[model samples]
Structures are given as C-alpha cells and as structure tokens.
Target: MISKDKPAALILIDIQKGFDNIEYWGGERNNPNAEENASAILKLWRENEFPIFHIQHCSSNPNSLLNENNEGNEFKEEVKPLAGEIVIKKNVNSAFIGTDLKQQLDAAKIETLVILGLTTDHCVSTTTRMAGNYGYETFLVSDATATFNKKGVDGQDFSAQLIHETALASLNGEFATVITTDFLKQNLL
Candidate 1:
C-alpha cells in the first residue's frame, strides 16, 4: 500500500508500441496482460489526481525501433498520456539519466514512485534502482512489467518468464518493492 503521508507519483516508462516487436527485443514476451494491468493503474492515478509521468525512449541508435523518427516510439493506445500530463524523453535506459525526471520529481515534492512499463529487466529495473538510490520509496509492479526471452551469456536461450522473475528477484530487496497489480487494486482502492 502507498503511504498517505507522502505524495506519490506513477511513472509509466517506455510503454511504447515499439516494444511489441518481440523478436527484435529478444523473443517471446512474458506477461501478455502487462499493458492492460498498467492501464488500470494509470486510470486510478488519474481519477485521484495524483502526479503522473510518462517516459519515452528516443533511442540513440537510429536503427532501433524506438528511434525518434520511428512510429514505434509512440506510446501505446491503452495507456497513452492525456493532454497536460508530463512526458519525459530519454535517450538511455534510465529515465533519471540525461533527463529532468529527478528535477521534476523534486519540484513536485514526490516521495514515492510506482514504476511499471516495458521490459522489466532493462529500463524498468534501471529506473527503479535510481529511484531507490535517490531516496524515493519505489514500488515495481510485477505483473505490469514484462520482458522478452534473452540469450544467456553461455549461449543458452532463456525464457521470458525466467528472465522476468529473475529481474524482479534481483530488484525486490535492494531497489524496490516488487509487487503485483492485485496488491495495488486491493490497497489503493
């Protein structure tokens, strides 16, 4: 549950259409309901008038699907930002790096961050680490974030489910509280 004493922000990181290109990211993606679950959370944040931020990745790699010029860089329909909501553009994995995310959060006096978006092991994980290090109470929604299968260092193929779980396991204690969408629905409502 979120603390009522401090202001919290819901950050949607790279929920861009580009991520739908499963094979490009790795292979099969886990958590097919990620976008739907994230959309539900976003609706809650909006109805309550809580602070919200949308992070967009303008990949530095021109060939990348998320490149600025690519339509794939556009936010997905389900959780697309409404007019006047804050949208931060980033060229890297971490939303806090080379962006005014920290500054915006600081300005808004935000103390807690609820992050859910894109591949759990990449951008989501990186931003969660920074959020925790920067002293923000961060919560990462397990079912609202997902990843694709990845090639192991030893040349083995890893399942998307395995990669997703491992990423959450690694970040659970040190970076953020790994939770499910059900947790939010039960407490926030």
Candidate 2:
C-alpha cells in the first residue's frame, strides 16, 4: 500500500556480526543472508533519494556482543551506510525510545517507513510495533530480517527462524505490512 505520494523512509537496524554466530540459533540458523538482502534495499532507497536511517544497538555491559567497543556492534559491511546517511544509536529494542528517530522522521516529512534488519523478533519487531503505535505506516522486508534462537519461557529449543516468521505473520496488516525484497524493488519509484 506504500505509494510515492506518501513519503517513505528506510530504516536499517543492527545487522551486526553478533548475528553471525551459530550458537545464537541453536545451530538452526547458520547461514542468514540478511546483509545481502538489506543491501539491495539500501541501494534502491539511495538511488531514489529516499530518506534512509541506520540504527545501531549499544549494550550496557562491556562483555555483551553488542557492546560499543565490539566489532560485532558495527553494522555488517553489506548493509553499512555510505557517508552522510543518518545513523542513530540506541540502548533499547525500540530505536525511537531514547533516540531522535521521531524528530528526524518529522523533520523529513516521512509518514511511512520501510524496515529491514537483523533479529526480526527483537529490535525489528519492537520498532515496528512502536512505529505503528506512533501512527507511521510501516512495512517490514520479511527475508531481510533475522533473529537468533534462545531458550523459550518453556525451556524448549526455540527456532529463531520460526519465531521470525511468526513475528512477520503477526505484523502483517496490523502493526506493519510484511513484504519481500522483490516486491519492494518493483514497487519503489
């Protein structure tokens, strides 16, 4: 439902090296190509001169994988932004919680956001829900997002991939619309 009449922004979040580990997903999500997928979306946004925002997570503990000093905290090379792109750092799951994301969006007159990034069920989901609550039309690039597997509350081996799919399904036509890279590439003006 995103059209050229409504200004759209691309939000890329936390496609970091920490997501590349096998243990994070109980070995079920070994080869996630989120970076490549995100990169293609980024290219389209850049070519069209649409607003693009990059988000990075900062962990509170020095020992954490997303610690500011860790190379894993940096965005993967494939989706890394070019010079002059807006980059926002956050300490929570929602990028706008303590960041200037909302103000930036307002300044740019962006009413819609096309989101793609790492950990689909975490930061991506959090931001999508928040954006919806804040009245922004949001779309999630399903295949361009991923997540790591951790223990569920029931203590079972949760599948990160499955959880990601569930999150995508849950958001469709509610919090956000879930679309594919091909759909975006074809529909972007």
Candidate 3:
C-alpha cells in the first residue's frame, strides 16, 4: 500500500490512437482493451485529484506512424487529458527524455509515480526503469499496460497475454512496484 501523504503523480505513456489500427502492428497490437484499462486509471486519478501527466510519441520522419497529424499519434478519446493537465511530447521511450516531465515533477514536488499505458514492454517498461534511475518511487499498474508479442527466433509468434504476464513478473518490485487497479484503488483511497 502506498502512503497518500507522499506526493505522487500518474504517468500515462503512449496511449495513442495508433495502437487502435491493426495495420500499424500487423494485427498484433492490443488496442481496444488496452484503451479501456487506461480510461479506468485516468478516471480514478481525476476523481482523486492526483497529479496526472500524459506523454505523446512524435516521430521525426513524416513517414512514421507516429508522425504529426497521423490519427494514431493522437491520444485516444477514452483517456484524453482535461484542461490544465500536463501533456508532454517525446520521441523516445522514456517520458522524461527531452521533455518537461522532470521539471514538472520537480515543481509539483512529486516523489513517486504510478504509471499506466499501452505497449508494456517498450514505453512503459523503459520509462519505469528510468524512473527508478531518476530516484522516484515508481509503481507500475500491471493490468493497465499491454504489449503484443513478436515472432521469435524459433519461428514462433508469442501472444500479447504472455508478453504482458512476463513483463509483470520482470518488473514487479525491482524497477517498480507492480500493482493492480483494484489494489491501487483500495490503497490509494
């Protein structure tokens, strides 16, 4: 359980619309379900008045799926940021890289971060590890992040469910404290 007195921030990573389109990941991206989880987290955070931050991925090349004006590059409707919420754009996996996230955290006196979003293995995991390196106590909501599996060297394609489970095991309490939405809600409130 986390102490409510400690300053905490909700870090939302790459919950962009691009994942919704099957063509982007060759039908491997877990879309609709991932967005739903993100929405729940966002709603809870907003209701509790916790600090919330959003990260947007921007690709330098216009040909990239995350390029500016691409439909997939925008935040999904289910968990769009409200007025006055901080939204930071980055080209890298970690939200803090080349963004005002660090400064915002510093200004808000945030000591801990609770992260949830799309693509668990890539953006979520990388950002969680970097959050630890940045000296912030990090908690990863395991059920809220998803990653699609890829073709293996053994000629087997992995399932997104398997990837998500593996990431939960790998990230629990090392880079971040792994918790579920129910557990977090019980502890937070």
Candidate 4:
C-alpha cells in the first residue's frame, strides 16, 4: 500500500519513437515489452491520480534520431502525455539538469518516485541516482526499461540484456529498488 504521508510521482523517461531505429541505437535492444509495461503502469498511476512527468530527450545532435526537428523526438503513441500532465524536456542524461524537474516535484511535495524508461544504462540510470541522492525514495521498474548493446574497448560485443541487467544491479539498493512492472502494478493497483 502507498503511504499518504509522502506523495509519489511517475516519471516516464525518454520513451521516444526515435529509439525504434534499432541500428542507429547500437542495435538489438533488450526488453521488447518495455513500452507496453510502462503503459500499464502509466494507466495505474493516472487512475490513482498520482503526479506524472513525461521526460522528452531533445538531443543536441542534429543528426540524432531524437533531435527536436525529427519525428522520432515525439513520444510514443502508447504512453503519450495527456493534457495537464507535466512534460519536461532535457538534452542530457539527467532530467534534473538544466530542467525545472526538481522544482516541480518539490512544489508538488513529492517524496517518492516511480521511474521507468528507455535506455536503462543512460538517462534512466542517471536520473535514478540523482533522485535517490535528492532524498526521494525511488523505485525503478526493471521490465519497463531497457538498453541497447555496446561494443567494448577491446572490440568485444555485449548483449543488451546484459547491459540492462548490470545497470539495474548497480542501481538496486544503492539508488533505487529495482522491481518488475508486474510487481509494481500488483502492489499499486
């Protein structure tokens, strides 16, 4: 059960269409069900009338898939931001950087955060770390976030699932409680 003592906010980070360009994003991404899972959680949050923030990555790289001018910059159809919901635009990994996210969350008196998004090793991880350091009790939905594969310095190839799992492992306990989408929906709904 959620505590009424402290408010909670749902942050859907950078789940943009640009990420669909698999080859452009290092290819073979993990967690194919991330968007659907996120949408389920989003529905639950909306039904509960909890605070929700949709983070859009406005990439500075003009050629990037998520560049402001590109269609990929748009949020996915499944989890699009509804009217009156908070939408924060960020160009960097951390949503709090150069954005009024912290101020908005503070103004809403939010003390607990439920974060889920694309690219688990990057923006999602960075934002979760900051949220924890900022003293927010954060829960990261493991099945609702994912990442693409990366080539090592020695030219070794790593799978996206490996990266996703490692990223979650690093954040769990230290920064946020890493749980599945089912776990979150079961508890919250």
What does candidate 1's lDDT look like per residue over 1-189, in tens digits?
464556479999999999999988886999999999999999988887889999999998989899999999999999999999999999989999999999999998898899999979999999999999999989999999999998988999999999999999999989899888999878744
Model 4: per-residue lDDT, tens digit, 67-172? 9999999999999999999899999999999999999999888888999998899999999999999999999999999899999999999999999999999999
Among all candidates shown, the one with the greatest lDDT: 4
Q: All models: lDDT?
A: 0.92, 0.83, 0.81, 0.93
lDDT per residue (tens digit) for residues 1-189 in model 2: 555566589999988777666664356662267778899888877876778899999888898788899877888888887899999999999999999999999987889999988778889999999999899988899888887666878898777767887888888898998988888877754
Q: What is the TM-score of each candidate against the true structure?
A: 0.96, 0.92, 0.91, 0.97
Enumerate clash totals for all models, in the order shown: 0, 1, 1, 0
Q: What C-alpha root-mean-square deviation, in Å, does candidate 2 show against the real structure?
A: 1.8
Candidate 4's error at 44, in angstroms?
Answer: 0.6
RMSD, candidate 4, Å? 1.1
Pairs that collide, model 4: none
* Candidate 1 error regions (>4 Å): 1-5
Cα RMSD to the true fold for all candidates: 1.2, 1.8, 1.9, 1.1
Candidate 4 regions exceeding 4 Å error are 1-5
Q: Of the candidates numbered 2 and 4, which has the greater lDDT value?
A: 4
Ranking by lDDT: 4, 1, 2, 3
Model 3 stretches with alpha carbons more than 4 Å out: 1-4, 29-32
